[model samples]
Target chain A: MAKYYQPEFECMALEDMRALQSEKLVKQVKRVYENVKYYRDLMDAKGVTPDDIKSIDDIHKLPFLTKADLRDAYPYGLLGTDLKNCVRIQSTSGTTGRRVVAFYTQADVDMWEDCCARAVTAVGGTNEDVCQVAYGYGLFTGGPGLNGGSHKVGCLTLPMSSGNTERQIQFMRDLHATILCCTPSYAAYIGETLKEMGLTPDDIDLKAGIFGAEPWTEEMRRDIEKSLGIKAYDIYGLTETSGPGVSFECEEQTGMHINEDHFYAEIIDPETGEVLPEGSKGELVFTSLDKEGFPLLRYRTRDICVLSRKKCSCGRTLIKMSKPMGRSDDMLIIRGVNVFPSQIETVLIKEGYSPNYLIEVDRVKNNDTLDVSVELSPEQFSDTVKDLAIKEKALADAIKTMLGINPKVHLVAPKTITRSEGKAVRVIDKRKLHD
Target chain B: MSVKQISVFIENKKGELAAATRYLANHNINLRALSIADTQDFGILRIICDDPKATETVLREGGYISTVTDVLAAEIEDKPGSMAAILEVLAEAHVIVEYTYAFLAPDGHAYMIFRVDDNAVASAALAGAGIKTANQEDLF
Candidate 1:
């Protein structure tokens, strides 16, 4: 039987959940309009007021908060409550632009932890399990969020922030950790380490793994699952939305269940800001329904995905979101074709290649050139240059089939491609089209 | 008999081959024979060193991808037809030679290293033809 951290909310009736969201959305808008002057001015500029946001249905009237808005506001412009009430702050890695720092009050932290706890429970975690959080602890939301969630689920938590792979495996073996939480890439690395140490999945006690924070393919999920002998679950969240507990995968592994009571999600046409209907592939927008310290209404997430209200077997009524295709900022337009790094990754893993790849997009003579440098593993290494060339050509053909654009594949030595401890830097756009 | 030859993957960039050779020299590892097969993007540096195991370890520690493969090292006369005679025996035995490199041994003898598709057939054919082949310890 499926267990739940908060059954009342997770299994709430559809109508009751919508009613609850409407109630929370109305109160949240009023609070943000009154306390946050940055958003208040945006609302004023849009000629909308608290009275215009009567319920969740009227959310369209509110102004959208984007990364640019956050950058414009900087440190404290988006704070819905006084600084004295704020307890902690988590921040983005800021690889794209300026870092986005999100603040939280005591209540806000508790709410976020509750959402994470629900995610843990959905993954069959309980007090009997030993949960190891390998996500980076400080600044990054991945570690702290899952750490708190494990604590809330009454599990003996190991706050083993990323790296130190040997020690991670040591503790995992010594303590018989049952659940693992970290980015998908880190989990894959750990699995690789386990094999290198001559240890199999049977040597460890891990039963479930929650992997996210970066885009991963179904091929990668299967690879990790087989490597670790654990049912890998995908957890989705961003620091902009109070870390990684916003939505989490259930046993079904189809999509993640969003904590709709705390976060109201909408799919928007990224180009025109028009709200896309359910199941439409578009950019995702979120609203913190009850956050006090930093309450953002209609915050543009820039994650492209679809929202589905289709009935889930896990018995959670919270809407489900497909794994994000790719962040809008991470999408690369090469040779006038929309290409995502994740698409390239899917092809690489499917072709029995390591996910550690570097994509260099360059412009030469008014033409876009896609060059992929993939690390050749020991198993794939050939003594003859002809065989290696054939492998490279085959990989290039496979990528071309997937992307509809020819790519020059370079087979590099193993470990030549940098392994990421955090989010991996996969793409280097040398085109400089912005200039 | 066959000897272990370490093949290191080296990118075809300026100074990459020097860097790899320098890594071995820094470790005081001596190479008996070496050959490089290059493409536009990368090259495979195949070497017969005093200690194949140590050479592989040092190269790996230096962040070079390498693997050890068994290659037949047949002692051949310095005459022009000597190398062809060894290949003719293997060709008659239907054993294809993938690549070959010759080096002068310390004893003033020439030896040809043959990477073949079937090592067992090539080794047997060389033995049937009364050709002398070097083993792993014979080179050092």
Candidate 2:
């Protein structure tokens, strides 16, 4: 049977939801225009004002906010509420360049937590269940967002962060964790570890899992489900908007239900920025309808996906967003962490190595392996294999420090990587993720 | 002085060793000794050829990565304890051998090549033990 955290909000009629969203958008626009000078200047430049946005229909008139804009307004430039009222801040786990920091007021946290609570409830989590939060803690929003939401659902929350798979399994077995929340990759790792320790899924008591913060295919979901003996769910969120739980999958795993009351989403043509109609695959853009500290209006997500209002078997009237097809940029997600080829290039240049390199990503035994083949500079190259191996280890360590994930580095002969006339094919992702 | 060995990196694929040997054979190069140091992905085919330059040139022209490395080579008696006695001296001198390979020469003796961390120190240790190292011409 289908369950809901907030039946009144999740099953609200289309007209009523639209009315609620319009009122929230109007209020949010005025709040940003009055307090945020950065957004106010953008609105003025686009010949838009708070008066122009009387309803959600005028959301198109607002200028779009891209990642570059967030970088430009780093720290507190886009904060809608005063710092005194801001209770917490979450940031993207980007090690290179600037990170997108999102501030949250108490009410913002409450609403975000409520959205997550709905996700947990939809997956049949309750106060009697022990929820294990294995997403990374600290700056990354996955752990804390779900942790807070699981607490709101009154579940016995396990605040265990990512890593230490052995200990995670021990606690899962000892404490009988009924619900698991983590990235899909880590969940897969835990499931693999569980079997390696001579324990089957029958030994554990988990019933469901909430996984997100990285894109995972349905094949991975089924694999995890079979291994962990749990129904795996996908949750969607961005640190810029809030965190994981901006939307969530219910009993019907077709797509994640967007918390439409809090976030008004639209699909836009990435090239032209024109709003695409419903069910069209394009760049996802979100407007925080009821945030206080950091309210982003029409923020471009750069994730290519579709939105549908098709009736769901789970009986929720909220619109659903299809799993993102792929990233519209050069960013690649390896082992549930965002990795940009430019980040690797930055490390290479900083280490006084040639910037020409090729990244080969492959999935072996349900784990993503990153192998980087870089051209050895003439000065760094040596006849001794020991010296070359040392250089490779040094470069690999530098890249790991930059990306927070280890990569196998191979120092090849100079001018080895194939160079083309146009944009170089720097990344060769062999993982057939979509298939 | 130690012998100069030509090392060609062979990717772990079928027909790679054949391709490397075919290039050397086409150039009329005779291999005095050859050994392969391999891992999962690739292997290093170390060879003491009749002509190191020609072997490297042919391999390079055939799109193979080849390098010339100096390694200590000593001709020992074909008896079992002879090679062990030479290694015992190097171990007593605290000289570490990175890798070693042996081949039975046509002259009824076993010639062993040792890639050591310090070639000079290994040479002195072998000389101290009355084992004279071979030069490139000696191998040919």
Top TM-score model: 2
In the range A1-435, model 1's lDDT, one tens digit per residue, is 339999999999989998999999888888888898999899899999898777789988888998888888888889889899999998864322356789999999999999889988988999999999999899888899999999999999999998899999999999999999988778888998999999999999999999877666687789889999999999988778798889999989999999999999999998999998999999999999999988888999888899999999988889999988756677675543447787788889989999999999885533468999999987788789989999999999988877667999999877878878998989998866432
**Model 1, docking class:** acceptable
Question: lDDT per residue, candidate 2, A1-435, as tens digits?
Answer: 337888999999999999999999999999999999999999999999899998889899999998888888887899998899999998886663647899999999999999999999999998899999999999889999999999999999999999999999989989999999998988999999988999999999999999998878889999999999999999999988999998899988999999999999999999999999998999999999999999999999999999999999989999999998887788888887788898899899999988899999988767889999887654563445566567778989998888888999976655668999999999999887754
Please state the interface RMSD for every predicted structure, separated by commas.
1.1, 3.9
Model 1 residue B79 CA deviation (Å) reads 30
TM-score of each: 0.61, 0.89
Fnat of each prediction, in sequence: 0.62, 0.05
Best by DockQ: 1
Residues forming the 10-long window of minimal summed lDDT in candidate 2 chain B:
B36-45
Clashes of each: 0, 0
Residue A142: error of model 1 in Å? 0.6
How far is B110's C-alpha from truth in model 1 (Å)?
Answer: 31
- Predicted structure 1: lDDT: 0.88
lDDT of 2: 0.88
Instruction: List the pairs of residues colliding in candidate 1.
Output: none
